[model samples]
Target: MQSLVIPLLPELPGLVHASASGTVWAITATLLASAVATPVAGRLGDMYGKRRMLLASLGLLVVGSAVAGLSTTLIPLVVGRTLQGLSAGVIPLGISIMRDELPPERLGSATATMSSSLGVGGAVGLPTAALIADHASWHLLFWISAGLGVLATALVLRLVPESQARTGGRVDLVGAAGLSTVLVCLLLAISQGADWGWASGRTLGLSVVGVAVLVAWGRWELRARQPLVDLRTSARRQVLVTNLASVMFGVATMPVRLVQPQVLQLPTATGYGLGKSLLVTGLVLTPTGLVMMAVSPLSARISAARGPKTTLMAGAVVIAAGYGLGVGLMSAIWQLMMVTTVIGAGIGLAYGAMPALIMAAVPISETGAANSLNSLMRTVGAAIASAVGGAVLAGITITVAGATVPGQNGLRVAMVIGGAAALLALAITTFVPRRRPPASADA
Candidate 1:
């Protein structure tokens, strides 16, 4: 639902503009809320019970979707979307639960499937939302989301068991507050900096304050008995580098999302544009999600055979190849589909490997928090990708039918940048320790 709003914007600019701050908050609300919710929910899941928290998260999703579905105005939409954002913790929590409940040998494949669901949901949601938007009232989107959330909640309640892992201690309230503040400040600055002007006082001030708060937050975490994030475990070579690579992979994949839809939907009179409708555009990208789901088990097999580190590097290469293909292949729908599915394949392999890599390095007790932090790193990378892609597209624009749109050259530049990020991730993955360190409580 968060991502569905973006592609829907070009189709419903008027309806979005009718909202509180226009469509800006439509995307920002979810991004900011998710950034705040993921780590905090992870901590809560760690301290209490994972299944209980998972249920709570899905409940938020159901309520959020219902709220958005009923609203005709922007404020209500933003509020509902914020509620949906709170559910972002589900994936990481699910991964941690698998780590705890599944057999050691089964952990890799199970967690891989869980991790791939993140991409799968977004991939399927985009086109599915587009189809509904094209065929019915836009409000129906939320109603459908709510229904699915209800179904997911019921299935999880029936099929999944709560993990026995526990880190019994007081929830570090101060750390949670500090981390939330830092993330909100940093993401706000990044997401809005382009609009506010990158060098503007508001952007720079928030950036500085976020950094200052982060320093203090780190100090607080170091001293706390049960920190929201276990910095020591996070600092280990394998854990640290995997997190870094995850960020880069996030950065690389996000632009494909932002750029491709625009290229596909732009008017053909623009010479380079494919001139497809929003529904058609979504259909083109649908295969990418299907491929990710299909490739996830294969990704697990590769990780099992060669270790997750190899799987990650191979994913990075494939992602870079996809972006490289986009630099030339984006002119035709078939070419775009091929490019997106290939990128999806790479993301499937890389996302599947990340949890395995983190789990190997961190103690079982710390799995929820550790996985949450890794998830947060990817969120950070995605935030940066949105900011960078926005700036590039906004800077280079052409007037089509008296309205400004991003130039074809700008789209190519974005693809190239994405490829570079994939290569950077590949380089970082190389630094991850080849051997897993023994997991201990102290780590």
Candidate 2:
């Protein structure tokens, strides 16, 4: 939705013309809400019912999408987007269900395949939305999304089974509040920092508030019985390492997010960027989804044969190695394709193993919260990368044609940072000792 700002900005009439600050606020709210809400909903579903929660999530998305489709003003659009954000938890919730319901032998690979759906979702959404906005009414885009939501709601009713782990507990409202507050403040600071000077009161105030809230949240979790996030479980050597790696790996993964456009938009004179039209850009990048689709199951095989931990580490190393090579080779179109395929393959392998690691380290009952926290960390990492990546890109300027054009320097810097981040992920994956999970009570 936020990405729509560039193209949609020219289309909307008489709107206060959203500033970057406002846009950040909207995206921040949606991203943070989605990250926290998904796990909270997942845990709730585990205790009450996933089917009910899934339907509710889909409904919220429909309402949000419809509202966004009809929205003439920005506030209403933001409201709709926030509501839509609730759907982010669907994948994690779905993955957690496999753990609670599936047999051990079938669970690992199922978990891997389920997690890869994130990549698939993003890759699909970008192109679909791009095509609609480029060639058709943007309104049609949201309407179609709403229609899909309705269909998904119907499917969930017919297909998803209710979980039996219904346990009575007061909803962890206090814990939820604490965690949301921490995330909101920290992300606000990061998202708003560029517009507000880093040292200005807006940035400083949010940063201070964010830190204090997070610190307080930590202290509160230590004493809370049914914590929103189980910090202790999260701190386990295996869980802790995997999630720490996720944060860095997630951040590092954004180079493609940055580079894809550069590759497609760079002038043909440079002999790299296709210089294709907007629709063409989407079409060119379409191969990424197909490659990821193929890599995911293959990654699962590697995970199964080599152990999830080893698969994850090898994937991270391979990702960093690709970026390092890309620096020298990305000048050619085929080189760009090769680099993207390699990176996508690595992501498939790493993303597939992350959930397995988190599930292995925590109590089965806490999978919803744990996976959500991991999801939260992944977004936080990505958010931080986005903030810093923008700064890096802005600082480096390249000369092209008669005008001073931005060279690939920003991308190179970002990729190097990504490579370093991959190394960090490699370090984090090692502490998961590869010990076998104990036989289940059901097993």
Candidate 3:
């Protein structure tokens, strides 16, 4: 769902009969909704049932896709996207379910595979969405997504069993509201800072309000009987370091997504631009996803043998290496493809290990909320990367003919920053305690 509208972004203004700025809400709404929903859904999954929450999320996706498919205006599309975003908890919930249903011997590989799906979907979806947008009516994209959602819902109902593991507790409505407010305010500020003027009153006010609310929210969570998130668990050295590394990995992942497509599709008249079409750009990046999938088992094996910490550190090293290579090799499509593929492999290794680390630290009862918090940390990292990267790309630009575009220097700088982030992740992972045997779900 994340990549579904990216290919059509340039045309959305015309399609929705709105200004570009107005149509941007379609994208922003999804991010905001996902941020707010992920942890809340996870907590609900723990309290109710993972399968039940999973189904609920899928239902929302189906409804959202259908709404988006039928929309001719920005507001309805944004509403639809928000519903789709509510399904963001599915991945972490799936990971928690694996913890409940799968035996210890199979848990590592199963969770690894499930975790890697994030990259697989995005990488594969990009080309698929691009192809659909290129050949068919754009509405067909959402219709297809809705169909897939239905199929997935059916399959899950038929095959997946609801786990007996449950953390029976009342929902923390107050904590949920507090966290939602914090996320919305902070994300809005981060996401729109460039467009709204970073120093503007609106941006600063939101930032200040978000931080203030966060402090209050932290105190409330600590005092609540059934907190939305277990703050004490999250503050543990293992969980804390792992989440911080996840954030850096998130930052590392963003530049390739943002910079490569622009570099590929920029007019060739720009000295360094490849000038590939959108379809070609998507095809080039497809290998990255394939490589990530192929590396899942390897990630699991390394995590099993050397521990998730080692796997994470190795992945960070590989990602840093990929970005370092990217710095010197931006002129050719094959070079960019090679860079992305290497980075994807690194991501596959890192992503697969992260959940293992989190699960190992938290009890089975808290798996849903714990894993969701980890996912949210990554989301926060991506938001930061997007903001900083946009500033960099926009800050350094050159004119081609009558058009202003990001300069080659800006692309190189972004790659360097990506590499630095990866290295930072590696350094942080070094502080993560070595893995312990995972806690059994029934324990």
In order of appearance, the predictions have TM-scores of 0.96, 0.92, 0.99
Backbone clashes, each candidate:
0, 2, 0
Candidate lDDT scores, in order, read 0.88, 0.74, 0.93
**Which of candidates 1 and 3 is the stronger one according to TM-score?**
3
Sorted on lDDT, best first, the list reads 3, 1, 2
RMSD of each: 1.6, 2.6, 1.1
Candidate 2 vs candidate 3: the TM-score winner is 3
For candidate 1, the per-residue lDDT at 346 reads 93
| Clash-forming residue pairs, model 1 | none
Model 1 worst lDDT window (10 residues):
12-21
Candidate 2 lDDT over residue span 1-443, tens digit each: 32433334345443435654465444665776786686688678666766667678888889988987887667877787788887777777787778878887788778877887777666566667677777887677678879999998888788777666544476778777877777777887786677677889988998898899889889988898777776887888888888889998888778767766676777877645567555555555555555666677767777678788988998898888878877776665677777777777778788888888888777666777678778777888988987887777667866668654446767778888888888888987787778667323232
- Once superposed on the true structure, which residue ranges of model 2 sit more than 4 Å away at CA? 1-26, 268-274, 399-405, 438-443
lDDT for residue 322 in candidate 2, whole number 0-100 = 76
Top candidate when judged by lDDT against the true structure: 3
**What is the per-residue lDDT of model 3 for residues 1-443, given as tens digits with 9 covering 90 to 100?**
88889899999999999999988888889999999999999999999999999999999999999999999998889999999999999999999999989998899999999989989898999999999999999999999999999999999999999988888989999999999999999999999999999999999999999999999999999999989998998998899999999999989999998899988999999998988888899988888778888898999999889999999999999999999999998889989999999999999999999999999988889999999999999998998999999999999999999999999999999999999999999999999987576666554
What value does the lDDT take at residue 198 in candidate 3?
A: 95
